[model samples]
Target: MSPLHLLQFFLCSVCIHMFSIFTYLVYYYDLFTSSHEAQEKYDFIIVGSGTAGSLIADRLLKETNYTFIVLEAGGKGHPFHDIPAFGPLLHRSVFDWHYETVPQENACFAMENSKCKQTQGKILGGSSKLNNMIHVRGNVSHYVDWFHGKYTKEYIEEHFNYIESNIYPLRNIQYDSQLSDAVLDAAKQLGFNELNHQNSLGFQKSLLTQNQGKRWTTSDNFDTSKYVLTNALVEKLIIKNNKCLGVQINYPKKVKLFAEKAVIISAGTFNSPKLLQLSGIGPAELLKSLNISVVKELPVGKNLQDHVGTGLDLVLFDTSQSVGMFDMMNFFNLYKYFVNGVGPLTTPGCEVVGFVSTKNETIPNIQFMVLPVGITADRGSHLRKSLGIADFVWDNYFSKLFEKYTTTFFPLILHPKSIGEVKIKSQDPNLPPLIDPKYLSHPEDLKTLVDGIKMLTKLLETDAMKTIGAHLNKNHFPGCEEYDLFSDLYLECYVKHLTLSSYHPIGTCSMGTDASQSVVDLTFAVFGIDNLYVVDGSVLPTLPSGNINAAIAMMANIFIENTINQFNLKTNQHMCSRNISFEELFLNVCPVR
Candidate 1:
């Protein structure tokens, strides 16, 4: 056997043993398999072992009497998964669902070629497995709106706190590269206020999920066996009389399994909606187009939302350490990072994050990512320049390698006015979802990113920025680069092609008691379905101004609690009288079977 295959096998074996019995809470439910059908039907069968599913099983497994099965769509972390510097290693690999967007009209005719691929991870880590790794909690208003705006729940505030306790936050994140400081000073000069946290405008720094240089994804935190499923694809929901008894999991090598208890759909926004539709749930009109049976008619694939960032590259002097682009020493530094958990390779070129409001007073809607170096291009798919623009955006401003170049990505986050959708192309699970993010379809969204770019440029003029030799791209704007570079039209065009999804997709299976727009209730159950729930970003009522992986972990806890309470429906009288705090509810219960 090839050495690479042998190494892969060894890694898989080690990972399995490390995670299995100690943390994994999987329960098999195939009618064709073990007659050990004698085991309790289980309390729940969690599907799509990604962000939400991982957290859900971690909490549920605390109870010994109840059984939980977490079915993953793919296996655990990749070789580079644990390495912070190798963040791009997981992109478009076996883990990503390289979905494409339907041509958007509002965007420049130029965007169709420059921006097409919409990426989301398909592995145990989910998108958290293959993202830029910049972490933010967003503004406080993002959550306030969710509690007061839609779900309108009284206990949501407390639930939010519970979410914070479930995981360890990656802190003490800093960069040894001067490029990191240059990006921040540039933004500050442009008039944008730097925040300590990624989302809050009051100076919350961009807090990452990295712990001492290693990625802090579930595998690094939770019991890997409990959440990370290897090679488990959920074909469809096994519904009996409108209730989800289990899932139809295609394990390939093993016979199919039938989960007895309830089925929770955490297969991300796209897959969860498609699975629901495949099992006869979603918009009747769209499902009809697919010629599939409609079980419960609702907007399963509607109201998609994502934060889009527009890339504006500036060619600078090569002195800037723009990642592995220069110094061979940088690669050696990365080697130190993965092996010894220190040095340049561990930092994802993003050190200082900002949370600032634009000229508008309505709300802070843009999230700017400060990169230490210039980005090459979208790493997902190959460039299709023949369709439109340049083969590669040349560094018009830079003359040599020693000239450090700084790239600023202005992310127009969660524009309330803009919305997108997901659709299934066929019955096949292998087909990527028809993800049309309908970005900038809303004029206001364009304005947000435009103002953000304007703010970014404005910050560069500040006194602190002069030390870094920062300059606006007078020639970078598509139509109006020369017109002050921050003119309305220049900002508009930049916002259009420059703004792309942060890979944080949610709101499709929004959570609420209201059925008109919501796909799941507060307990995460499908409104009309008897025993099913969605526990991923698909269920988020609104996008928090920050990173979502943290929230996904919290929501899993809330959903598990709700499911347990519902399962023991008769105990409301006794349990309610005892008034056990939500925090202590699971302490008395044994580990889940």
Candidate 2:
């Protein structure tokens, strides 16, 4: 090679190697890590704008005396977030993280329904903006388990109750839709009970995450006066003096801000754990491979237990009766929903939720969600395979498939003992996390689905489904049809072909009294860190009993409340000595008409 060409090649190699080394060090260990050049001040700064972060920000706003900063990696959610029918439409849009999991062996080498890529929200509402709004509260036993999980912690039950006050309100509607009623009818025909349990307390009826048929998000719950900002993007957490001061966030404008107070990481299950490892907080061994220095060896991205789900898809031959996105009637109804808050547009896909036991038990090990429409065509996944999906919009593959004639019900493996982890694909935060959901990695997880599938097949056999001519998509792999029953070979192949994430990833940065299984205390504080806290799905010690959106919001709200309370008490006590007037608050209030 010529000398000049050689020099160019060497420099490029050096750049790649340097970046690789920097990422590895950050991933494995971190103690010297903090915000870069952050000296600005505020009361609280939260990272991520998803379900949990938004709730935390909004609830903290109840304390108007405090100055808060919200750092979102994705942009703001749209009015579409209020429309439940548009849930699938939101996937691969700007609001979604659009992540794909690392390829699995049991599942197809290529993307199948079970192993299809999934999405998380990047907008203000987080995943709640993108998720189906089925409101099934977990069984009460789960919370009792949550409370009992950290019995040694200080006042855990108090945290749970405080979280409740911020989540479920008394005033919601009970309108019966064609979707939910059908499932309840089917379940009852088979002698399964359907009750009301959307409050994170019980699970008998399909609860609504809607406020009067409009979607309920963190923005709806809080921001009583302020307009929730649009298109905010966060780049990095700003740390200083061995404490999390705030974040160094860059917007589309490219202007960087240094938030004061504490930078709370609530980036949800996928992003939160990934961000922590990116910011240099993960396993020592993995971090060493990436060349990132160990700032805190507190296990930033281990113990990843994701709630995996699978489904039986039935397609009606007659497009005449089959509901799809292209149906002009749907468009008008959707528009009407935005205006009057009535019509099919108000319901997100999977409007019905059920908790069931594969083995006979009062407690549920699986969660079933029913949708009226078929899945949609994902331009993102199409482009990713035939073309290419941009990293930002490529995560959710299954939802992006085919236009809806879906009439599908998905069930989550609720109590799986398996776990997974998040690693850096590269040092670039712009690139997605190297996600390893390790879905259905455990043997019992497959059995849970086997039971769930048998249950769903029965539901489809009902007059509601069969009258509609429900038929399975039996042509995925080579031998999928032969094992339609519960043979080990069939179960493995079927699971590989049909297994997919419910998109509710939890426990990456788990919370527990046992350091062996957890990454934090019950207080949501990262273990071994003085000021760092995790306020998203990543901190849950185990998978929650029901839909993760509301539960995540509850966890985030409680974590923020505790932190702000402590911060406020400290400031209030400090103010008392200085004799500063509360009049500053009155002056700061936005003038009302």
Candidate 3:
């Protein structure tokens, strides 16, 4: 053979080999795939591959013989979503739904036109991918009150324990910041006891939902091998005779999926209610207004509740050394994280958390979060802009405090007397929902927050805080400039102007025994509907004291157990007598009483 011919042959061989290797890599990661086409029918159709939906799919696939599919509105999460510190950056990315509240009369004064930002994760892991990774189950008393004797404390604890397998507490690090130490000492000086573990009262280091230095989202807990259709937006439910059969999805091309056994709506709080209303399962008046034929006249979008909180930024006199947002973005720090899984890149930002009771000693009404580094206007602009904060808030409140060594204290109101609602503006499922949190609507809600702020102020005055030279930023707020700085009235005005949502929206499709009061029954089945259930944050009858991720997981576990037990009973009875129907058995097994 000629030398030229031999060179060409060798080059062609190398190109073919490289192409084959690239193809293998693409298939290995399950990347570059089109929407998964559904079978003619599945045993279960779960909408939204979120915190609850993903876990539900895992349980059903692993513990039963049922065939199921998860329909997700967004694609697989971004690469940074698995990192602990990139949580804030995930907001407004393709991963977030980026829903905003309607203009409010009572709160969100600092945001754009009194509208608070309502962020929900649109990716496979849902909001768990975007949350701060604080793994808190909230106080047990709050759960007892919400359940109202329906669920015993023992039952709740059991479910929590089962879900705890996925969680790993934040481990102690060798490098300690002066800011963190000062905050802990201040908590002690204020007569707060250190909590030994999560779900307990008093102040302590936060227990994160992370393994090592990486985030452990719901996506990590579940089996990803199960079939899931990403970027497939579910438009409406296919319902007939008060029974949910399947879902209609819009994946740039319309497709309908049928479920033979049941349909579960685990589309988080905002989208779940919206989907129900679109399917003519909401309030009769709302459906009629939208020209939708009402299938069930139930309040599907009422009783929306969320945790609201206000924060205070404190400037430290010493600027010799401190961590800031830029520090995490440093190439060296990123290298450290990628190589050794340590450094600022592993931090969840909010290091310490405290639970305090403002009204009753038995139940915690407020949760305190301490961040070692202060958030300045530049950082706020980067983060809050994506969160939908207005230019007015950035200029008036945040911009003045740029480039300062500081620490921030967030006093979160656990339970608010005020309630909100979610409503659909148009019949189009593509448009966002009208979210109205109506934060601080009740007079007492604001009063309770003020009391909590006072407690924070006292903590700042402690000797430990003084040692770190911590002092409140006295920047003049636009609406509260008339009040004297550091006074009670001034602080009250500050809180009213600067309050923000803790991002824990719940109870929109609340669960209760009565059909009139809630959208779902205690068993998580939608009221007045058959073969339909909701097992997401929307069905939480009340807001927990802390982050609601753990609670959502626990509810999914309980639902799985209840479903399996019911299925087993029906199967056993059918073996004994062929005369018994599944519907009759379900009704007999599950009664409101």
Query: Which candidate number would show the highest TM-score if scored against the true structure?
Result: 3
**Compared with the true structure, what per-residue lDDT tens digits does model 2 show for residues 379-432?**
222223321222322333333233334456677788786667887766677888
Q: Clash totals for all models, in order? A: 49, 54, 0
TM-score: model 2 vs. ground truth: 0.77
List runs of model 3 lying over 4 Å from the truth.
1-32, 166-176, 196-200, 312-317, 377-381, 578-593
Can you tell me which runs of candidate 1 are displaced by over 4 Å? 1-42, 108-115, 147-166, 182-199, 226-228, 253-255, 314-318, 321-332, 360-362, 377-404, 476-486, 565-593
Scored by CA lDDT, what does every candidate get?
0.61, 0.60, 0.77
Candidate with top lDDT is 3
RMSD of 1: 8.4
Of candidate 1, the 10-residue stretch with the lowest lDDT total is 378-387
Model 1, C-alpha of 401: deviation from truth (Å): 9.3
Comparison by TM-score, 1 against 2, better one: 1
Ranking by TM-score: 3, 1, 2
Clashing pairs in 3: none
Residue 556 accuracy (lDDT) in model 1: 75
The residue-by-residue lDDT of candidate 3 on 24-82, one tens digit each, is 45433444566466676898999988778888887787788888899888777545567
